[model samples]
Target: MPARTYPALSYELYPPRGDDAEESLWATIRRLEDTRPDFVSVTYGAAGSNRETALTLLRRLLTETALKPLAHLTCVGSSRAELTDVVERLIGGGVRGILALRGDAPDGVDPSEGDLQHAEDLVRLIRHIEAPRTAQLAAGRVSVGVAAYATRHPDSPSEEHDIDVLLAKQQAGADFAITQVFFQPADYARLLTRARRAGVTIPIIPGVMPLTSTRRVEKLGSLAGIEVDASLLARLEGARSDAERRRTGVAATVELARAALDHGAPGLHLYTFNEHAAALDVLDALGLERPPEAGTVASL
Candidate 1:
């Protein structure tokens, strides 16, 4: 049999807050770009708080490098007209891909009346914007991606129900799916199988967030609904020092990536958490090297 195809490795980034933030982000970006990711995505703040800054960073990436940039767009507080405008703006700025989401509602606002309640709605809107009728003003067929949760969504009553919702989003026009970060490779494998069974045929990239700090890992686990394996948690708890914890975390992540690759995962989606050292260390442990030049995909 031919070599199994793995999904391309990529990463998610958030826009910076100020000069210091910008400097830090740029440094991280440079390190990640050296790895030659398949693509790098820039996230938008909740309720579109960082819309302009996100766009500016996206444009900079487009102009300054050859890397394919994916922009995250959420329909949390904006109207259909506003979303359409934002889509148009991104296309006008030469962005060809988007990660669509139903972001958290603005502070103090009830989510029920939010402008966009679901990701499928945003996917549909993007499809409409890319239609031939609007093709004259827009780039042709922008690639739309949607998020998936390996573990049940925090608000979801059941994992099956979440998979069904993901399938519906794919049918509605999402080109691909990127899952929430999970520590165990098995969780991702099972989740992918369940999603396929639920009729979600798009590529489901497993998201991996390395635990660089125990406190941060615990916080992220709570937020993402990832069940930290008791054994690993115990190992972390037994660590004698902060450095030991970080080292153990890197080793754990490396093992997870190896298992994922062996089990036929399409690709790894790393959550850098705006820090590069831990991710870089994990990549090194996995024997993955940076792409030779800018915008090139890293090879196994």
Candidate 2:
């Protein structure tokens, strides 16, 4: 038999907020570039917030680095026209893939939602608009990725509903999905089982991150509406110093990633949080990901 194929390794980054942060992020970007990730995703704020900053980073990545850029566009608090413009800008800037998301709507804002009500709606829109730009694309099509949930979405009534939504997105033309940050290996396995049983065929990549501190994991759990691992929290809290805490965190993350890969996850999509140390440490520890041989598929 031929050697077993592992899925691609990718990373997620967000736009930096200020000049100092921008400088720091560039340093991290350079370091991550050396890893030759299959694709590096950039997140724009909800309702097209931080649009310019995100655009600048994408443009720089295209020109300054050898990495492929996967731009993130969220459907929330923006009109159809606004979304059309953003999509055009990304296409014109040579972005070949987008991760569609139905982001959180702002509080106290009436009509805080966009014309695109769900991620599936955004998927349809992306396919429809990109139809006219096929000649400019090297692959002759856009690769649109959506988010999958291993746990119940905060607003969703049940896990089955979330799987149904994912099915709808795939039907609407999403090529793949990267799940929200999940803590347990069993979480990813359960999601894959449910999704396959529901007829969702897209390759769903597990999004892993290095939770290097008590506050980092707590904040991510709160934001993603997922439960934090209490034992991992306790371990970090009991660490003798910041360095020890990071060591514990990275070790826990390596175990999580290894288990997911062992469970047959299609790929590893790491959340870099605009910093690279812990993420790199996790990569080094797992040693599961490597550069794909030439002419092989490097991404899911």
Q: Pick the candidate with the highest TM-score.
A: 2
Best by lDDT: 2
Each model's lDDT: 0.84, 0.88
lDDT of 1 by residue, 1-300 (tens): 554343487888999989999999988988887777888889998878899999999999999876789999999777888899999899878888999999877788677766678999999988887786455645458889999987889889999989998998998999898888788768777887898887788988777888767777788888877777878888888999988988998999988777777776777878887789998888888886333453666554
Write the residue-wise lDDT of candidate 2 on 160-221 in tens digits.
Answer: 99999999999999999999988886898999999999999899999988979788799989
Error of 2 at 93 (Å): 1.0
Q: Give the lDDT of residue 153 in candidate 1.
A: 90
lDDT of 2: 0.88
Compared with the true structure, model 2 gives a TM-score of 0.94
